[model samples]
Target: MTTTTENRHALPTGYQLQDYRLISIIGHGGFGITYLAKDTKLNHEVAIKEYFPNDLAIRENDHNVHPKSHQDKENFAWGLERFLQEGQTLATFQHPNIVRVLRYFEAHNTAYIVMEYEQGQSLSSAIKNKGTATEAFLLEIVSPLLEGLQAVHEAGLLHRDIKPDNIYLRDKDHSPVLLDFGAARYAIGSRSRSVTTIVTPGYTPFEQYQTKGDQGPWTDIYALGAVLYRIISDKIPVEAPKRVNAIKLREEADPLPPATKIGRKHYSERLLRNIDWALEIAEKDRPQTVSQWAEALLPPPSPTEQAKPVKPVNRITPATTSAATTRCGSTTAT
Candidate 1:
């Protein structure tokens, strides 16, 4: 992404004086700031993400800075389009494991996406509070996580950013809810002059470090593998090797630390193999679909655990209910 200098005079908290009642500041990032707000009409809490505009008007009015006359409008347009598109894309997804976008609107020259307010800790916080999660716990978390991704992949979208921070654990249902579709993209076409990288470095795919070409399911697979690695090893995968001097999987990349080292039994060889496959240098060699990865990780049902068949019984008589029992008793001589 085009690195713009931080706007020192820009508003730190992104709440306007009008419609939204800002509860508290939740988070901030390079592109925008998130706030916990209550919608006056609905009287319910929601997350309102305010997008920062790249336009000169925003710079001069909001930040007390000025952009040169020749500054590219393309960046502004791209940001606006992505901000709106993410809302539209997320609004269509109806899965319980994904955050639901309630509304999208532009006001005061800033775009906002209102979404369900989650009252639970993020995966990042969970990891911090308790060290590395146990294997069973990790599986419990990642299984539903993969299921959520399966929904996203089926919708023909890519969540370019998949990290602990973006994964929320809802206390109400005790299920994982994937959030922040801001960096998401439709995988069908190539993005133009967007010389910007949209994902975090260590969690991103090796190919994403390159300046050209579109990313697909393999990009997300690489990120998910990195996340799993960290949960299991309590260490982030070494920064995706440099693009120009990127190391191939078989050559210089380090072998993943064994699960046994982390106080867990050695996982099946197939599981380890698939994890390694996801971290492969070439996207083609990795599992092409999220469901494929899920299949590799999910254990098969046991024969001994199968449900027993119920034997069929011959009918003795037709059963009936009657209000007029006296007349029925009189006719029961047979």
Candidate 2:
């Protein structure tokens, strides 16, 4: 799928950056432009990620990148360093579900990261075509995706952006490959300092839009829940901000029911409950680890296992809270 639309600002084809020749634009976003390029030296096609920073820089007629103004230069430089850091961090990831960034370099007054370009469609498009994803398909995609994400978190980095659109399903084995690093979003959000919002509406948790929201693995978990919700229901969840508003309102009606609630015939209760658990507006109410959430998606503990649990107690939610509206489970307006 075409990752981005509107030829807003992209380097023309044949443009050279080191040994890479720009073939075409693969994706474009506020912080960067991903291009399909040919590595003339290697004789291979690669995805070159350039630090475009649409909000901070622009392309001049001289074919070089420049900050929009003197004011943006500092922020632009900071974001550039972070982009390089993102490339360096991702270059070390050797997981199958993670996209590989082969190499990165600086040129044209900006940075570029060369990644292996997968010839496949994005999860978003796959969902659009299928209308609704099956439980088996959802598990097949999410479980391994979580493993990739676990690697990312262990590296001390966060992929603040984890929406369906950023997930590419490789054509070879239909395996999910995560695209886009959260470093860019964090950089942009840091620069704007509350003036600009750098988030996907439905996928971003309410706390994410806030610079001070207690973000962690759970933040990504919420977005993961939203993505699965979309895949199964084929509908966007209520945007985070609006959901927050409804929560505060208490009587304005919640947006949509949990996945199991809306997708009874389409999904199992265990799957839906886990999705709901991840989507708790409160960070304290969701799973704190991939393993914690994964357990919910699987069959509950066996009777003997429950009787003599070997694992440390992991509360799916605050114990004081019940599974009702006044408690943790009920998100009324269902």
Candidate 3:
């Protein structure tokens, strides 16, 4: 339940980032802060993400980014490059479910990526307002999300941070759009392995906490699975650190309780199993791809739908046939 929550450190309403005028603070997190701004030239709204790693850097009164100390210079520069790279990479994405990256630029002694201002509430807000959603409704939201994530994977990118708050349910038709790529998060991983930047307790997989944690498409898949679990159960999955400690203390016990046990009344067995598979403590046990995880959501054919089983009538076992032959040989005909 305890996840990282960022505070407001946005520029004043009239302040400008190039041609975009800052309107209000939209989102703030460990890695960066986003703002609702108007592109004066284009006359449209855009979300601008500023590369400000709160742990290592701070925004000065003059709106210039500076590291906390001389010690953080290398890490800050490295992260800024990674942030710019993320923008460049995200700009290439054209999927409807993936939030389009409008443009990226350097200013205020750091970098910023411009994005479309989506008119919708986050999945987290929607769930809080609507309570537990039905399985069908969950599938409708999860399917497009996985497809979009698959596109991200194909492009050799990993959405390291994926939580309910990061997914937006658009107003137009309730479409899901993924937000926030951990721009400065990657470099900070190796820069100082001891330090923690962003931690979305329940949604974040165990491997992500480690600096050398082996991650792949499965990493994002694990998060997506958690999102599905949260939507249907209306409960945050147990945090990874707590789960780890509990698991170690009781080797025989399941650290993360099965979703089926918690959401049996609301969800089908098949649906719960898929969620559990993704929440598996071991990475190898989880679905390696988004499609692999989503495939099991659909239940298999029921017994009635399958071919009917035929009962044996004239069939006999070896022993029974031998006894019948012996009786015939003894002339015990009836």
Candidate 4:
């Protein structure tokens, strides 16, 4: 979905689902609807995602979701299983930068994944409010997100979606939290073998356009690079398919301008270059891992600097030292 659209079939407010009581609809997409809910047992708010693929299912007067047609029954069942699996996988993650999944369960002939409700605005909204985010601002958000993404990769999963809209900046500290994972969406699309449901235009890498394309950490790197591109240039990068066509014609014909040329004056060369490197059209050409990409953004150690043995510096205060001295100087003989 280009934007979160209204779902008329969403569970009504105050409706009970296991321990969660629906408070309001958070968002809806092709595959599901997320709701802001209250956990009655815990007496806390949480986000709950309900499986309701619009294409294959419908909600009846009784509020139970069922396959729209007999033909969709198998696909819906398969997708539901994958959705449950997605919830299970997410529940295992404990990273601060990734949304925390509390629990998941089946109800009303469907499934729901309950997650911690975060207080923040989306990166897209943040970008829209503050035009062309500063490099320092973007780094503070991106660095921690990369660590979270790296953790996802290590767990043998891919985000598939990494646009600005999917990133949330916590209101408390403006720290980025990766949200709305596309695992179930991708899994459903794979089961149905539909490519249209997979790509997110400018943020999607060219490999995802193919039916059997090789996807890995680099796929997410491209999307993250595109997000940074939007923040720096105030425009989304050209669609990956279009970029692929341009590259086929000639290197100079590539439509997406290099970040180095776009933001060099305002941002550090290393930062811009790292963005450009991640945005490389070919998977093999981009940095293979988050560490590989982040290291380039750091200033290299000086040539004259040599490795020294580790040392511990004193962190005591003079006032505390004087107080200790006074205490040791004299004592009452009790």
Candidate 5:
């Protein structure tokens, strides 16, 4: 994840450097390094995500070389295809709340994706900096996030990793933008026997931990619920309750702090109820689509409420102003 392009003969910095001027390092993760760079031709700042192709290729090679059986080789190939496919799939989505992928290419034996540079703190950082967000603020942030998820849902993409860390808040415009489509899976695709469980433990759905089953919108819904629960309670939900022999055991989950505790004083019961519904254990019991969950939290206005008549204000003219001025006796000489 090192951002230094100094030693990379394949990626030298200068007028001759590959189409971009590396400004500085931005962020780094296990997969690759992200650089805040300027597009030479476009003269716009962009985020350059350079994937560790060597690592991926090496990992693929290792899996092939040290396979326990012939089946292991097949599994390795499947995983490689999936990893590449994810990058291709993310390239297709174009939404305002979702980070835009400008370009995708390979250099120095590594694949790189150029994207919009989002200047903001992640949801995790906001929580850490502010301790806990107010209920209204949480709703403001989450509503837009859900809208972004809806776009992904419509595109047949399941964001397997939908956690606070992946939700960014842009300070410039005060809007939430979803990030990290690396773990996104296409709904309609060939099933590869690749068994890579890509998910964060507490934020991920229970079904994700299972070795088998098709992941879909419902799976993303579970993660969305987990994100909201954390924002509201400031406490991550405990792992899905486990069952014991002959009895279905469940642990007592922590209740959300009262609105009074946060000094909001008054709030809607329906909103809280919807939050709980989204966090339900059974996927079938939860809201099926992102839009459904969003609508539940943000219910439509009643017909009577919308039918209310509007009142017009009286107009103040120059004549009225002149009369008022005369009454005050503010004129000097003509």
Candidate 6:
């Protein structure tokens, strides 16, 4: 049998990985492959992510993943450990806006994270189908997502990758759920000589491209800011590297146009200003945390708005970041 990229790296349909039966491949990225699978024991669908960095490892005919070379073994094992760590950390949260990790385990010479399968189109698809999003629609999605992300940060972890495609809008309530965390990918890239820095061109900030970049809550803030820019302006912000290069040459202004200028008429001045603040080329200039940026993006509800009866479903509620840390992995529906 000839080996191609997808079939070579991905487990074939009907292949069983423990209790999960692979139905098909849903998505694949540089760090892993996400499969749509059925949990035979539970008799339900789930999304299982397998750690297989094609650059460092290859799938042998025996159906076990092995390092491409002896020199790559240490790096591959290090990344697998990090991948497992990410799943364990994520399994700690019970936030509604975050994707739920049901469990994680190791087999087939790699690791797998089983997450609750959500039915929805990605924010990228919604934007393409609906054109520019309304200020109301943007708030509905961003507010809840920020709370979820804040929880992740307070847990001493970072999502690292936040893009429209990584944000999913559930079909049931149109509520947003964050997906495809980049922590493992980012950690591996930082240490492995074979892998380059993990970045999504327009969404990644200037600092992410640097090996020793000072990343923190501010790093995620920049990526989320870029997501908002894409929604309101219907155009992606200029890539961060190009913007920084223009500054180095003593340019008078950033290569990317300010959100305030593009979204002023449709969105409030406060909203536009916050978007620009999040996308600041200098890390020092951006909002330092999710709460800080969200304050401006999401204002306090008015007396009348608060006085009204709150719907039991899909209403934004206040949550402390610490609360996210207290929960263990048992909250999702079976």
lDDT of 4: 0.78
Mark the regions of model 4 whose C-alpha exceeds 4 Å error after superposition.
1-6, 249-252, 298-334
Which candidate number would show the highest lDDT if scored against the true structure?
A: 6
Going through the candidates in order, what is the number of backbone clashes in each? 2, 0, 0, 0, 0, 0
Candidate with better lDDT, 3 vs 6: 6
RMSD of each: 15.7, 8.3, 17.7, 12.2, 13.8, 7.4
Q: State residue 79's C-alpha deviation in candidate 6, in Å.
A: 1.1
**What's the TM for model 4?**
0.86
Global lDDT of each candidate: 0.61, 0.77, 0.75, 0.78, 0.57, 0.81
Task: Write the residue-wise lDDT of candidate 4 on 1-334 in tens digits.
Answer: 1224456989888898888888888777788899988999989989999998888899998999999888789888988888898889989999888889999999889999999986766777777736456666766767677778888988888899999878876666677788888877787687778878877898999888887888999999989988998888988889988988878866657788899999987899888998999999899999887767766753443343324332222111111111111001111100
lDDT of 5 by residue, 179-209 (tens): 7765412111123322243556556665665
- The all-Cα superposition gives candidate 1 an RMSD in Å to the true structure of 15.7
Error of 2 at 153 (Å): 0.6
Model 3 residue 265 CA deviation in Å: 1.5
Can you write out model 1's per-residue Cα lDDT over 184-232, one digit (the tens) per residue? 2321112433324365756777677556745788888888887776666
Q: What TM value does model 6 have? A: 0.89
lDDT value, residue 40 of candidate 6: 100
TM-score per model over all chains: 0.75, 0.86, 0.84, 0.86, 0.69, 0.89
**Per-residue lDDT over 117-190 for candidate 6, one digit per residue giving the tens place of the 0 to 100 score:** 97766777667735556777777778888888988998999998899878877666677899989877876788
Cα shift from native, residue 200, model 6 (Å):
0.4
Segments in model 1 whose C-alpha atoms lie over 4 Å from true places? 1-19, 53-72, 184-197, 242-270, 301-334
Which regions of candidate 6 are displaced past 4 Å? 1-7, 193-197, 304-334
Clashing pairs in 1: 1-196, 1-197
Model 2, poorest ten-residue lDDT window? 325-334
